[model samples]
Target: MASIVAQVGADRSEAAWLVSTRREFKYDLAGELRIQLYTTKCSCRRAITWRREADIPDWINQGVKVEMETTTIESSEVKTAIARLREKAPFVYGLTNYVAANLSANVLLALGAGPAIGSAPGWAAAFPAGAGAVWINGAALMSSVTPDELDEAAATAHKAGTPWVLDPVAIGAGASEYDAILASLARRLDAVIAVSGEVDYLCDPAGRATAVPGGDAKMPQVTGTGCSLGALSAAFCAVVDPFTAAAAAHVAFATAGERAGERATGTASFAIAFVDELSLL
Candidate 1:
């Protein structure tokens, strides 16, 4: 009576199971799927394939045919995303920290996107509905707007069906407020970025996660780079799907950063070169 279930999304589908009892793989047959993992996050990665009837794994129902294929974000899609972003010049509304706001706006301008920073009363709910895309930085929310405004902005963005990216900044260790904000936004999740060192995991609501790896060694030395990246993500999201947009932004920024790094001697000069590189691209 064991069965396999697949929850399908627009671009991807996934079926996962708990690693049972250190000795077996358990399957349920009650016409309901239950997911419980011993570990919070699975580090071991595997390919899901059930090619032919004879090749099917022992755990799977042999009579059932599981169609599995990984659809990744291609370089061509990145190129298309860039082209569309420049063509559309998406109006990006950002709720970013004051210290980084100017630089973030300059970055968006160089990338051919109109950037607007919002902090005024009633701006959160109104601007997102009008923007091509929105980026909400938790650091900015903590300093500028009231606590409830972040929820309002996220809800408004979700209700408007606008593509928005929430940059959690720091996940833990002194960022409990940010984590609390994310916990509240969980139900209204659209696109979220997961960073593991230089590589970024762009994840969509449907569980489609793509790893886009690209960055310069000196890129972190500059100020406002992270904020700028979030705004760039918003601009790209306006033109393409969230996953592709995140990939394209990372790719684009890396390309610019690498070029700038090669030309500049110090972080101060590299910052200037980075903006110049973005515009030149």
Candidate 2:
């Protein structure tokens, strides 16, 4: 005889079945098993019997019961970290593309952080002097900061041990030279790289990668979401480690996007709710 076990959802209930002959099995949402038994008739009189466990073993049941609780614990921790971020209200310096500058600054402000924008050489070095974190966004619309300015800003953040976030918007799409500059900065500076797309990819200084999935389909239709993500990253980075900051920012933004889409009629409405949700957090 053989036995099989299946779990339902967050509930601890389980269904186990014992089989003696070839049969098929199926399950319902409540975790109850439906089995079909097959047998062959014998010429001589004979009897067959089947048995099942009254309940699942304690060890097996306990294993499945803890998954949901663990997830809850993780989510609670993230919320606590966000509270700390709001309490600190750290300053986040941005050298972002013009298209995203306003949105990025507003995101930082809504999240209870200070936002400062400057791309000049003097500002690059001076901004990090008393800032909690620095963000460099390379998604220019008309003009962009020179490669040297980016390097200088990165060097300043590195020296100060300030957590920095890099958003290389369309880096390799057409600007190979600029892409090279951003790539080089990523390798040298200890910063979080937030690669925005259908799914956001976050890379830490040690080369560890974490994928954050989930967002509204309309998110891409709206500009500056990626930029807001970078700004939010800096907000979290001010109070948490770079890796956790990046992942937390992604989770916050993706969840807010999903929620905003539910109430929005169009892209413009969605954008408004997106910022509102960030402030609500």
Candidate 3:
């Protein structure tokens, strides 16, 4: 499914619109015009031309109530947010796994943010002192940091009023205990929980959620995608609210992954292309 929305009047003509090629239309509004085209294949290049105003259904103008309120961030809004993030150049501190540390740092830097990877006994507690945001990757800490130390670090970040992002890598894949620990930490701080998979899900402390879909299938074959997302989320948090930050990171990475996949032949090349695409953003 794909959708295009446009206002019927000249007064609102200049207002921006959102184009989504997803399976569902979720929103919280009334009297909005939605033109949906159903296609068996999911392709961004598929075009649906609108000829005239009479082509629109009469019920679309009559108005309807939607129980679910889903907001798709406009491309313009994401562009503005990306520019703001580049201008702010906030410092993002990460506690990522060894496998993803390098890529995570590079991704943060590519997005025009300062990256600091620290996992010393007390580094997490001290790093966030002057950092714009903190990122905690449990996959990396499984061997490096103790549970108590990780808790202390999260507590320190919470007390310092710094926004943090938690990436529960492999949340439902035989990591129930670890998942609970991260979930508990998420509730204690102003944090964004980024759960990466075929469909990335981001949720704020208040339980509001955003879903980002559309990425290369090779994403799972590559290492550190989740970790890079966590770092990018922190980078975005430096300039925007946690929810917006998470959503932006998701869209940016997913979009970049798709572009990178088109140019690369294998995992190694895809990884390189992914970073290049991120920098171009």
Candidate 4:
């Protein structure tokens, strides 16, 4: 006999609905209610059975217990699948010299990714072995941190076989240095994951971005359009194969951004709404 388990809201009778049974069966829900049934080629019937396990074991050992009572069997396979996807969650590293960078990191965590924040050259080595993807934000640059640090970090992530996402906040908005840094990182990395209207350097692999034109425009203005992109990348990296992860991340971000727009009036509103909407995804 096979068992199908689902959440509280699912239909329990579907087990037999599509199957043609030669005999009888039972079902259980939350270990309380039991429904027993008998089926023939021409008709089907059900009756209540004993609520205790001892009474059900008589038919259980014979593999007919399923036909004797109605207890819900939780499907462990679905849990296993979710776990397997989670096992691949990316070790997200953020490099920025701005306080806003902290907000970006928090965004990653809120979206269900593993986030590491710091701009130390030492962090570069950790990228290859520990993370599935890296987010490099050129928002606030430290002259003490040479441009080579960005190059080395991107290169290390690539060598470690992880994808790197670059967030060049306000690149052309007079932050020429930031734009240059973004471009340099983009050229060094195998492929870049960037947001729209930022540094127009990278081509998104379709499903890798999370920003759109509508909504409050408040959240996007506050968090770099790249913030959602990075978080979405992190989320998809947890659930899918590399190729599809980029695409899935983009879809998730875009949909949520659009939804956030509908419910928000500005960045502050979007910030609150964005978090609320993520759980929906």
lDDT values for all models: 0.55, 0.53, 0.56, 0.41
Best by lDDT: 3
Please give each candidate's TM-score.
0.64, 0.62, 0.64, 0.50
The Cα error of candidate 4 at residue 126, in Å, is 2.7
Scored by lDDT, model 1 comes in at 0.55
Screening candidate 2 with a backbone cut-off below 3 angstroms (N, C-alpha, C), the clashing residue pairs are: none
lDDT of 2 by residue, 91-177 (tens): 988776687788778778877889997676588778865788777654432355765565566557666666665443332211222
Ranking by lDDT: 3, 1, 2, 4
Candidate with the larger TM-score of 3 and 4: 3
Alpha-carbon runs more than 4 Å astray in model 1: 1-74, 172-196, 201-213
RMSD of each: 14.5, 22.8, 17.5, 25.2
TM-score, candidate 3, is 0.64
Model 3 lDDT per residue over 101-149, tens place = 8888999888899998867766867987678877766555555655455
Cα error, residue 36 of model 2, in Å, equals 63
The CA lDDT at 274 in model 1 is 91
Worst 10 residues of 3 by lDDT: 5-14
lDDT of 1 by residue, 103-196 (tens): 7898899978999886888888799788887776655744656546655665576667666665544322112122222222221222242332
